[model samples]
Target: MTIFWTIVGIAIFFVGLLISIAWHELGHFATARWFGIKVPEFMVGFGRTIWSVKRGETEYGIKAIPLGGYVRMIGMLPPAPGKTLGRSRRTGPFQGLMDDARAQSRLDVLPEDADRQFWTRSPWKRIVVMFAGPFMNLILAVGLFAVLLMGVGQATDGTRIRDVSECVVPASVAATQEVEQCPVDAPPTPAAGAGLLPGDRVVSFAGRAIEEAQGQQLREAIRVASGPTPIVVDRDGVRVTTSVNIIDNEVQDFQDSTRTVTAGFIGVSLLPDYVRQGPGTVATEIGSMIVRTGEAITKIPERVPAVFGAAFLGEEREPDSPVGVVGVSRIGGEILAQENVPWQQDVSLFLGLLAAVNISLFLLNLLPIPPLDGGQIVPAIWESIKRNTARALGRPDPGPVDAARLLPVAYVFVLVFLGFSLILAIADIVNPVPFFG
Candidate 1:
């Protein structure tokens, strides 16, 4: 059963990923068309085409590898200065690469495409076109998070008894054991002594209404109570009054599991329920994820050694370590296969994980390093600044930024990215994140 669900979960993630990639490309395709740039291809994934359809002038298709996708736009790179397309006389170290890039960029350019070139668009419009893809990812992430946090709510302890312990166990023992129970010589806990049972809706602790109590949590009420305490619970649709001696015992601290604090024990576990959160909570969580993801990006190079160790030397993988697409899909499988987990909770977790992935994609594509949307953005911004400077100095329009000159850098970027992808794939299969999820 676990194996079945694991496979199902991985399939779900893979499908979801392809949809995300398609949606990302849609952003670029739509904006480019809005500005009259010729788009020849709108592809999801890479490698050989699995399916395709020609609509209008665009060839929309799915490819074999589900890693990434692209939209082939006409004139993504302007022609070499003082040279026609496909006719540049290469003269320098990187000029051959530039010429090739310019030639490739011109393949979709027809005689009528002179005014429809991507490089001919206003710098601000070009910026928008480049920015749109990642913006879609961000929007999708926010919508997913909103659904999980605000619509579906979050798992939190509620004012109801899920279980009642038969006997009291020391906090240190309870922390280490899979299940805590009484030995033959152990005495019954106060809750058990008072006959508290599962399915009881806790109404009040002492004289305070349970709903009005601090955070509506019974633990805090029990922790501060001493001697005999009155408890009210809604049982079988009727209020049932009871009393128990709130015994002081060492328990795991709420804020930190590593420390123990002396607190009152009643021997009952609160039932967990979905508690709806406000938009503010969603904003805070999104903000935190952004910061964390940004920090992780900065640390990728530093973490490669650790990834290598885990892959080759049987070292343990850190919980917060980097993971590739394969690793993440595997994690989705593990999450669905978790035992004794509610289906709703599982779906929420899976969606949250997907949202985090989207956030990573959003940030990764925004990196100002050619070939990437962010890299394209850099040159557009530079051209914008340059044209503004030229106009102020009464100089001639310098024309479009020759993005082809960046082909050498783009080649290096692709090589490095592919190399990292290879390492990540090896590590994912050999030493995937130890998902004790």
Candidate 2:
């Protein structure tokens, strides 16, 4: 059963990842189509096609790898030579015959000089097409976060005390007279060597029902007990009766702004009750999450430099390293194992995390590094500026870019990025600092 559930969880996580990737690529595809660009192929994933079908001029397909997707647009980049014809041999007898036949067969097709080709479109239009993918990813992240916040509501664990040292304890009024030492911790404290297991729920103390107000009274009863006081707890829905000895102690209640006079130390943590939210409350909570996520992203540059410097210098630093697929899968499994978390709630949380990941991917890709969209846009902008200057000087616009000169630089940058990603992936696997942890 555990294995089955783990597999299901992994499958769900992978599906979500793929959907996020597809949504991002869909943005590019849609924008290209809107501009009347010739989209020769629209594909999800990379590598050889696993499934494909031609729809009008576009060949839509799914690839073998689900890591990323793309839409290949005609004239967006240099065109490849025909299967048997080399680029330099475009006018050979055989090539000429084939070209003539191809040209004649497509007599109704739009001429090559048509403005629909991506290169013929204005530079601003091209920029829009390039940026749409990342923009869509950001939109998806915000939407997912909003939905999750609205659906599940937001609550903090009671263990995180809003007011320091202030706590509610249970006691019986009739049995307990003057309080001596109250139980400091409910289940177990580090000092007492007592600990609460996963499924324990407090029932009552000294025959008194454990209510919100009566908790303090119960502490007094425990303090006054001559010997071990009887305590009742429900574990996994089964009632278990036990005795806990209490030690006398004076504790400060910061919330009350006073010291509590009590006895007996029973070490247990306070657990918070969930407060459900209405639609309006949910909207507010979601908005808060979005704001927080945005702020966190903005801090990455500052935080990442410090972290990397610490690692390089071998200095003592917080172990908040990145986690790769292995770590994420482990988290998904653990979340699935947790009891009382509704399926929809779990799905919503998972999707929110996935969206955040996509947002990161989108932002990372926009860095002005070679082989990225930003990198390509940089040169395009420079060329556009040069062309405008030349036009003002009454000179002819520079001829089209020579692809041979750019390919080598792009290839080198891609290799460097791939190498860096591999290093990070290895680091993540060996030294994972989980997000939830």
Candidate 3:
């Protein structure tokens, strides 16, 4: 049953992935058409086309590889100075590469498309057309986050006491065993001695109302009490008042398990609750995710060595290391197959992962490197600046910036990315992250 559900979850992720890709490409295609640029193809994959339908000068299709997608617009590159449009003329070393790129870019430009070519549009329009794809991803990410926060609700530990401990045992002893058994010398837990029952909703402790303060404050109140403290709880529609002797004990720090701290002990466990989060909570969480992702990207140089070790040297994989698509999909399968996990929780986690993926896509596409949307956007912005400056100085309007010159740099980036992807894939298959455990 777990295996079947795992496969189902993977299938669902692929479907969601296809939808996201198509939606992203749709942004480019729609914006390009709006700006009068002739789009030849709108594809949701790479490699040989598996299925396609030609409609109104655009061939919409899915390809064999499901890695990425693109929208092919006519004349993405401008011709070199003194060169005829759609014609390639190589004059020096590596010039052939530039000429071939320009020629290939203009190949789909028909006679009527000469006026509607992408390069023929103003620089601002070009920026909008290129940026629309990533912006679509950002929009989807935000929507997913909103749904997860407001609709599904955030899992939280509430003030209700789920269970009370039988006795108080030393934290140092508990750390070394699966279940710590209280010895004759151990003291009775405060909650147990106070007769606090399960399902009791804590109202106040030491004159501080639980509803008006955070859980940490309540904890601190218990820790600081030198003697018996008054506690109020709601028990089955009735308010129950009691006094519990807050005994000082060495307990494991709630935030850090490795260390122990002297605090007042009341061994009551919190009950689970789903707290509805506001838009501000959603924004804060998303901002934290973005910062963490940026930190991960910046640490890639330092972490790549560990990836190689884990892939080929039988080393343990780091939990916080970067993962490729394969690793993420494996995690998705594990998340779905987790035993005893409710369907709602599984769906929430899966949606969260998908949201993170979309966020990554949004940030990656905006990188100012060629073959990426941002690379073209940078040149368009530069061209806009140059043209405005030339006009202001009474000089001739400069033609569009030749993006073909950066083709070699784009190729290098592609190769490095592919190599890194391969290594990560190998690491994922052999030393998969133990997310299930």
Candidate 4:
């Protein structure tokens, strides 16, 4: 059953990925066609063609690899300056008999014409064609998120609390009638040393029914305990009894005006769980995902350096550092395997993640780095601005860009990006961090 679910999850993930890529490419193809640009080929994936069919002047095909798709349009980028236009002539008797001899001849080359070319289009048209793909991705993400939000209600969980320790105020402060009590570094100091494990919920201490106030009292008792005392805890719904003797320990809880005081100590933490609600929808979920993703992206510059430093220093960083495709698939599989999560809830979560991934892809592609959609758009914008400047100064238009010089730089950048991506892929495969861990 686990294997079956894993396979299903992987299949669904790939399907979503393919849809994203195709939707993005479709935007480009549609826009290019709208502007009368001659699209030579529209294909999903790359490398050797698996299937193909020619329609009108374009060949639509699916390629072997499913990583990405593309729309090959004539005059996509600046053409080579030295390349001459091909001229065709027919001398056979069949040429004079047929008026459309040039069009019929498979061996004949067609001359390049300005009117039918993408380069001859206005700057606005070119911009629209280039921007359409990422724009479509963004739209798709937003739409999915909206659907999710509408299907599922938004609610905060206990995990969202900034500090679990602060949830309960120190009894010492309450005793003193102070508005704010000095924080205590009181450790779990389990009343008994019965080998209590981490994540064991303190259901009661000394049989006092451990509510918030009772738990605080237990902590105070442990702080003053000089001898072994009994402890009781709940581990995943199983009751466990333990005992611990408090040893003299000094720790700082909060840094305030003057001094730090010593408090009881234990080394266990409470695990937090999400409080589920049913007011979520596709739209709302997508929106929430977008907002969270944007916030995450904004913090990257501040966070990446710290992450790298911790990794270098061999610090125990959180297991949920960064996840790639493998991590996502594993999480998807886990979600599918869990019996408690309802089918609609599972679908909502999957769609929400899909929206987030698509949004990230859209933003990444819009970065003005080499070999990206934005990279190409930058030059086009510059060209337009330069032409406008020349016109204002009463000069002739500066001619097309030198594609030769830029193409090499673009190629090198693409190679570097691919290498970096390969490294990430390896990391993802070897150490897939589970999302729900």
Best TM-score among the predictions, by candidate number: 1
lDDT of 3 by residue, 26-80 (tens): 8899999999899989999889999999998999999998878999999888878
Question: Using alpha carbons, what is the TM-score of model 3?
Answer: 0.81
Query: What C-alpha lDDT values do all the predictions have?
Result: 0.85, 0.58, 0.84, 0.61
Per-residue accuracy of model 4 over 1-437 as CA lDDT, tens digit each: 87898778877877787788888988889999999888878898878999999999889888987656888776654443443342224344442333232223212223654455666677778778879998998898877755555444332221111112322334344344854533465343332235665555666655566652244355565556655656676767797777755455553344452344566544333333323334344445556666776676666556554444443544434554554555566666766766534355677678767877788778767776656777767777877888899999999998665322355556677786555445445555554444664
- Model 2 scores a TM of 0.60
Weakest 10 consecutive residues of candidate 1 by summed lDDT: 210-219
**Per-model TM values vs. the true structure:** 0.87, 0.60, 0.81, 0.61
lDDT measured at residue 342 in model 3 versus the true structure, 0 to 100:
44
Instruction: Please estimate how well model 2 matches the true structure, expressed as its whole-model Cα lDDT.
Output: 0.58
Say which candidate scores most in lDDT. 1
The 10 consecutive residues of candidate 2 with the worst lDDT sum are: 158-167
Clashes of 3: 0
Better of 1 and 2 by lDDT: 1
| Candidate 1 C-alpha lDDT tens digits along 63-91 | 99888999988888887887844566657
